[model samples]
Target chain A: MKARVHIMLKTGVLDPQGEAVRHALGSLGFDGVNAVRQGKVIELDLADGTDEATVNEMCERLLANTVIESYKVEIL
Target chain B: MKARVHIMLKTGVLDPQGEAVRHALGSLGFDGVNAVRQGKVIELDLADGTDEATVNEMCERLLANTVIESYKVEIL
Candidate 1:
């Protein structure tokens, strides 16, 4: 089984990399761009029998830094 | 209103950063870690009237590369 996790900053957090991308996009002719914030995704191929609780635990334990970000998991 | 976008590589795509992170985790004493794939999350603080279709279009056009990645949007 496979799972996809998305980790992102909470609102009001600063995102330097996304800002850089936004600037880069403007230089590359992407107009009307207002704002950008960057986050992370993690995909996992888990052993069979792995359950959602374990996955959520993983997110809280190591996969995500709860201080600045939150995470969502999608099973695929 | 705010929307969060997650961008990630499709299955079968290579993820150098995730591999690097896995290695780093191993060195940091995170055992039993088998695999990792990295992706991106974007947060959008949109105007009052922006719709989901437009947000998705943004994902396809500039927020994500369809050639290598897919995206999801969340409203908060």
Candidate 2:
């Protein structure tokens, strides 16, 4: 089984990397890019039948910094 | 309109970050975590009706390192 965790900055959190990417896009002549938020995706290949609860626990424990980020887990 | 781009390394490429994370997880006592691949997700808030072609071009030009990575674009 596979589990994918997407971790993203929380709303109102400052994202300098995302801002830099947005500026780079403007300089590259791509217009109308209103906002950009950069996040991380962790793809985990686990033993079969690894339950969702464990994956969620992984997210809560290590995959995300809950102080300023949120995460979602998807089983595939 | 919004667009989400998921960029991931091509198979066979060495991902030191992913490996480090895996090792860290093992040390943290999370067993059965066979493999992990780390990637980036870029969420774009765009002008209404911003077409997919434009978003794809952004991926080719700036969002992804085409040499060692592949990207998927999702419009929302």
Candidate 3:
């Protein structure tokens, strides 16, 4: 089984890296980029029969900082 | 308009960060994790009429390093 995780900073949290990318884009002549938020994606190759609950646990315990981030998991 | 970009390291490239997370998972006693690959996602809030082409150009020019990574763009 394969699991895909999308981890993103919560709304209202500051994202300096995203801001830097937005700035860089403007400097490169790409206009009208109003905002940018950077996040991460983790692709996991799991053993078969690994259920969604286990994936979620992995996220809560180590993959995401729940205080400032939120994550979505998909099984494929 | 909003655009989402997913940037991932090319297959066959070494990813120390992913490896580290896999190790940590094992240490914490979560088994059956065969492999892990880490990537990034960037969400861009753009002005109306910002098309997919523009987003792809951004990726090509700044958002991703073509030599080592590939990116996907989705307009929403």
Candidate 4:
């Protein structure tokens, strides 16, 4: 089984790295780039029968920083 | 308008960060974690009417390291 996790900063949080990317894009002549927010994706190969609850617990415990980030999990 | 870019290391590329995460998970007692891969997502707020071609150009030039990474662009 494969599980994919997407972790993103919550709205209203300041993302300095994202801001830097935005600035870099502007300097590179990529106009119309108003804002940028950066996040992470984790792909996991899991043993069979690992349920969604277990995966959710993984996110809660390790894959994501829930205080300032939101995460979504997709199992395939 | 919004564009989401997912940048991932090309297959066969060495990913030390991903290996570190996998090792961390093992030490944390998360069994059945066989393999792990990590990537980045960049969300961009763009001016209205920014077309897909322009966004692809952004990825090709600035948003992704084409030498070792492959990127996908999603416009919304």
Give the Cα lDDT of each candidate: 0.77, 0.94, 0.97, 0.92
Measured by C-alpha RMSD in angstroms, how accurate is candidate 1?
3.9
Please give the RMSD of candidate 3 to the true structure. 0.6
DockQ of 1: 0.40
Residue-by-residue lDDT tens digits, candidate 3, B1-76: 9999999999999999999999999999999999999999999999999999999999999999999999999887
Candidate 3: tens digits of C-alpha lDDT, residues A21-47: 999999999999999999999999999
Best by DockQ: 3
**Chain B structural similarity (TM-score) per candidate:** 0.94, 0.97, 0.97, 0.96
The DockQ values of the predictions, listed in order, are 0.40, 0.93, 0.95, 0.87
At residue A65, candidate 1 shows an lDDT of 89
Model 1 regions more than 4 Å off: A1-13, A20-34, A44-76
Measured with C-alpha atoms, the lDDT of residue B56 in candidate 2 is: 95
lDDT of 3: 0.97
- Grade the docking of candidate 2: high
* Model 2 C-alpha lDDT per residue in residues A1-76, reported as the tens digit of each score: 9999999999999999999999999999988999999999999999897899999888888889999999999999
Residue A52 of model 1 has an lDDT of 74
Encode model 2's per-residue lDDT on B1-76: one tens digit a residue: 9999999999999999999888888888889999999999999999897899999999999999999999999998
Alpha carbon lDDT of residue B26, candidate 3?
94
Which stretches of model 3 miss by more than 4 angstroms? none
Q: After superposition, how far is residue A23 of candidate 1 from its true place, in Å?
A: 5.8
How well does chain A score by TM in each candidate?
A: 0.94, 0.98, 0.98, 0.97
